[model samples]
Target: MKKYIIAGLLAWLPLAITVWVLRWVINLLESVFDVLVQGAAAILPLSTHDVLHQLVEIPGVGVAILLSLLLLTGIFVTNFVGQWSLRQWDALVSRIPIVKSIYTSVKQVSDTLFSSSGQAFREAVLVPYPHAGSLTIAFVTGRPSGTVAEHLDGEYVSLYVPTTPNPTSGFFLMMRRADVIPLAMSVDEALKYIISMGVVAPTAEGLASAPQTTRPAGL
Candidate 1:
């Protein structure tokens, strides 16, 4: 009975979460359309206002319009004038006290996660972290640099150790390249492992083959 229950949950939990996320996004888009219609009703003729409100209320129209707007924005941002305008806005944000550090850190993380060339959190690695007796999965963010790099021994990699079930927060460590064991698993597989709290491990054939023997300290 317990095995069956676990299997059933494994089948339905992902679907439930996906549906929940989609519903939340759709509701948010609908609210945006509703606000636009309500705001326009303040100044427009009654007949035109009713028409716009009815159109906005149609199911899925808000999502369609939102996607179209995003497409248009993407096109605009790729052009020279739009790039210049965005740079000026970023510069203004940088001049604001306290806001610049928060904004810059978020922007850099986003770029590293989403951009084609950025290397942050790209590789899955296995390391003896927190202690020699235990192994932890970590993501290779990149090699450390500047003053931190100077302190680390030759060829150290910067990586993050995410906690089970909640991956958004985790520890950042700079481990020696020789000490860190690079995993064969992709970033997505590693995430699934962490999120499922070790319940879902890929078959050995699916994982990368690597030397996993841990050495004692001072050896």
Candidate 2:
């Protein structure tokens, strides 16, 4: 009886969690639209308020409207006028003290991660981290910069060492290029391994072989 119950739970657990999450997200978005409609009601003319409230109550319409706005924004940003406006907005933010610090830092990270030229996590790599005789999975995040490059004599590569179960928060390390062990596996396969805490490692022979490491003597 206990075994049957456990098996039933195991089968339904994923479905239940997925449904819960979807419902929660939908409710959260609906609440935002509800608040907006309330505010519009308070200030808008009677006809406009009625239309806005009716539209807001339509299921899934709020998300569709939000997506349409984002598409329109992207279209606008592709033109010269939008680019100038963006520059002006950026300048205004830069003048603010604390906002500039937070905004610039986040913008830099987002650009690096999402830019077309940026190749961070483009490949799976092996690095002898923490100590020798042990290997760890790392993603190539391009070359080092600034003082880190100067200190390393400009020969090191930047890598993001993702922790198990949570890849969003990870450690950044700069190691000599020679210390990096390039793996044959693709980036997706490596991420799966990390997300599963290594339980879902790829079975391909390419990943099974240990990559050769050729470190520079100075390091």
Clashes of each: 0, 0
Runs of candidate 2 with Cα error greater than 4 angstroms are: 24-47, 203-219
TM-score of 1: 0.77
lDDT of each: 0.84, 0.82
* TM-score list, all predictions: 0.77, 0.79
Clashes of 1: 0
Tell me the tens digit of each residue's lDDT in model 1 across 76-131: 87899988988998999999989999998998888888888999878888878788
Per-residue accuracy of model 2 over 63-109 as CA lDDT, tens digit each: 77666877999889779999899889989999999999999999888
lDDT, candidate 1, equals 0.84
Instruction: Give each prediction's root-mean-square deviation over alpha carbons.
Output: 3.7, 3.5
